[model samples]
Target: MMGFAVLLHVMAVVIWVGGMFFAYVVLRPVAAGQLEPPARLTLWAGVFGRFFPWVWACVGVVLATGLWMIFAVFGGMGGVGLYVHAMFGLGLLMMLIFFHVFFAPYGRLKRAVAAQDWQAGGKALAQIRMLVGINTLIGLLTIAVGAAGRYLVP
Candidate 1:
């Protein structure tokens, strides 16, 4: 059970964080350079439409598995080191940011795309980009903390 939980947790992190890395680092520049505002906004809306659902799933699995590990493996938060705490804090922040992106900017982006409102879509995309960038950095940091924390935090 513990192993399964750990595997699910790691896989969820990979999906969420890796998706952000690809979108922010790889796709953003290409789309910006090759596409006009309309096409670009449309592309982003489509991309997010597909990716965000997976992110939602990842968030669920991550939270469930993380909490399971905390209570079952570590015997609750009290038994964990500072690194675990840090990872949890960062994860929560990332989740909150993602929720904001999905509910606020992503919604705007979709509506703008549907209405062919390039300016509004651009604004929404920009907001999403900024938030995703911040989340990506935090996610990377959380991964590192989760990986190396036991040795460093004790």
Candidate 2:
């Protein structure tokens, strides 16, 4: 049903985007201030290890629900509004960025933490911080677009 699909899609987006916001804004600052390299790095590595799985699952659910809504409820991509198209594009972009983060910097972060290589871990964390910050901003923008775009379009 449209209602169910919309609910799932929104919930998935909330989990992914809200998690990023919390990590980038709240956790990162407190962790950096309170913890030194080894502890900070360990915390992030552990945090990410736990969080990434949920994020990946959220990604799958969001994509599935979104497509279901578009094709089944809204009568395909052609029938959807520009807002839907924008949201779809932004969601795909976020997913691609997440894949890069998971494979590249996140991989290095895990390896560095395992090896107790603080320097490498720091570098990887910095990269992740930057990327996540960017993603968070973009996620917020996407939400705004999705929420308000219908009214704005005409």
lDDT values for all models: 0.95, 0.93
What is residue 120's positional error in candidate 2, in angstroms? 0.7
lDDT per residue for candidate 2 within 9-117, as digits (tens), equals 8898899999999999999999999999999999999999999999999999999998988888888989989998999999899999999999999999999999999
* Per-prediction TM-score to the true structure, in the order listed: 0.98, 0.97
**What digit string (tens of lDDT, one per residue) describes model 1 on residues 1-154?**
9989989999999999999999999999999999999999999999999999999999999999999999999999999899999999999999999999999999999999999999999999999999999999999999999989999878
lDDT of 2: 0.93
| Best model per lDDT | 1
Q: Which ten residues in a row have the lowest lDDT in candidate 2?
A: 1-10
Q: What lDDT does candidate 2 reach at residue 32?
A: 93
Estimate the overall C-alpha local distance difference test score of candidate 1.
Answer: 0.95
Task: Give the residue spans of candidate 1 off by over 4 A.
Answer: none
For model 2, the stretches where C-alpha displacement exceeds 4 angstroms are none
True-structure RMSD, every candidate: 0.7, 0.8
